[model samples]
Target: MSHPKIANTDHDVIDVIRARWSPRAFDLSRPVSHDVQKQLFEAARWAPSSANEQPWQFIVADRFTSADGFAAMLAALNEGNQSWAQYAPVLVLAAARIEMEKSGRPNQHAWYDTGQAVSMLTIQATSMGLGLRQMAGFDRDKAQIGCRLEPPFEPVVIMALGYPGAPDALPNEKHRAGETQPRARRPIADFVRYV
Candidate 1:
């Protein structure tokens, strides 16, 4: 598989946006530095939200120092995902609260707001030469127990972040290919409707 090439564009934002991809294989030997982790969270903190509710909450486990906690969280993941996810230096469980009062006593767009925060963090990680995979194939019940989550906060996505490793180290060739493939997107015409 060929490595994806970054397209040169006038807008600097496009460079960061285009470079982001989910890599399954990671260099487990090198742990993410505290400074970098703090930067990633700082980026998440600034993500736009409805009325600045900042509903997103993150539960992070440093694999090297918190092996037991990390292993417990990994136990809940699907076997396929667990194979690669276990190598990530940091496993972050992102959650958001459902704010009913904000939407006139109805369930507001908490999930949407949480997603925005996740996207921001992912991009920040990517820009810093790290790889990230946002996974949903995990046991929510076990995650809640392992992370000691409280009420009002629901588990949304589990993000694995670390420096990428060789594609050959992955579980299969398909995953390796996926790692190097250029990200595909729906044509703007398909999703955008202009009046």
Candidate 2:
């Protein structure tokens, strides 16, 4: 199947935005370069945060070529997700710490801010010819153990990042069909409520 064609522009901004999509299948054979990963993280670092707290932190486990700690982490993920997620070159555990402490009261905006950071990182990866899938189906306690996460740092999302792979390789027919589907979004009227 032919991939969607993107038009060239002075900066390719429009094409990048339009072509961005979550890809479940990844090319496990190809190891993502450190430079590329660094660039993606750099883009994430600049995302807006409440009060510039910049609370997001990432723990990356390179799963493509290395087996160290990879299996344990994969095991923590839901069995249904393991098939495709195992093929990703990198699995990032996005986390955030509760920053504000006023007489034992924890701030509520930290998670919200961290989510924004993840969105920025994913979009940057998409714009750079890479694919990312944010996942929440995992054993959080096991993941924290496998990823070596400490207290006060709560896991928000687990992300798989790598080059796109053939849809035929998916473990199930449903996933194969989903890989080729066009991007869908809720209608603007459904979301925008003018008070």
Candidate 3:
């Protein structure tokens, strides 16, 4: 069954932008191929960054090729996330380098740039008929340790990536409810102000 939650927009938007929505229900049986994975990251690689620093770094692991690594990545997530995210065949830890590579100064825009990269990744995934969910509900400490992140680099978010699955495939009612519910966003006027 296909569940497409196309956005209700006020103006014209790109198909991929309209089509992108994070899904908690991920197909457990289907694994994203390495070639496809490269394409996703390649999108992120082209994302603009402050001073061309390209602070984003992704630690990727998939159940098929890196089972133990995938388990470790899953363990880094909080229990609630683990409950639902386990079904995703691929797990990713997005990180950012806090310090400027050459200057050794703090880069305030590191997180923002990393987010832009993830945005590109999300659009790419959506175009590929895949689902990407960014979860803030992960343990920072565990992610740092599990992913072997160092001082300059810090965990930003954990992402569950895979093909969208049935809402009933979720482990619990709450997640299923989240999956089947209509998507919502504040009216454009609520967040945007024209000068």
Candidate 4:
């Protein structure tokens, strides 16, 4: 089954940005290699951060290797997310340090920097021909327990990653149509304000 393409670029854009789209329909049969998984995190590692803190961290739970552990990972996500995420070969909980090391002060831009890190990871996944779906619907407390995350680190987003699967193959009726939906974004005029 062919993966869906939904990007609608208004102007010229890089191929990665043009082709990147989140997919819940993941091919369970195809496994992402450990090397490729490391490469993805390595991309996130290089992201710029406040005071060069580089606080982002990811805890990957692979269904391909550890089904029980993967179940725990899926349990961390909310009910709606669990319905589809269980099919993904990999799931990652993205987190960031809430404080800075040098002065032991709170880093106001930590979350923003962490987001940049995830953006890098996302684009890198695209370049590698993998699909990634970053989700906000997860239980932070459960993830903390499942991933054994300690303080000084926080869970921000859970991403379902793998090869794109046939949307028609999804067991849920609601998501069979998700992969084919048109991609839309607000015009720059709506969000960008020139001071």
Index of the highest-TM-score prediction: 3
Q: Looking at model 3, report the run of 10 residues with the lowest lDDT sum.
A: 1-10
Q: Residues 145-173, candidate 2, lDDT per residue (tens digit)? A: 98888877888888889988888888888
Superior by TM-score: candidate 2 or candidate 4: 4
lDDT of each: 0.84, 0.80, 0.91, 0.89
Please tell me which model should have the higher lDDT, number 1 or number 2.
1
lDDT of 1 by residue, 1-195 (tens): 335734333345666776777889899788999999999999999999888888899998888878888888888788888888877888999998875545644337788999999999998998999988999999999888889888678889898889988878887677777776666666557887988
Between candidates 2 and 3, the lDDT winner: 3
Alpha-carbon deviation at 168 in model 2, angstroms? 1.0
Clash totals in order = 0, 0, 0, 0
Candidate closer to the true structure by TM-score (higher is better), 1 or 3: 3
Best by lDDT: 3
124-155: candidate 3 lDDT, tens digit per residue? 99999999999999889988988888989999
| lDDT per residue as tens, model 4, 28-90 | 889999999999989998988888998888888998888887988899999888888888999
**RMSD to native, candidate 4:** 1.9
Candidate 2: stretches off by over 4 Å: 1-13, 101-105
TM of each candidate vs. truth:
0.89, 0.87, 0.96, 0.95
Q: lDDT: which is higher, 2 or 4? A: 4
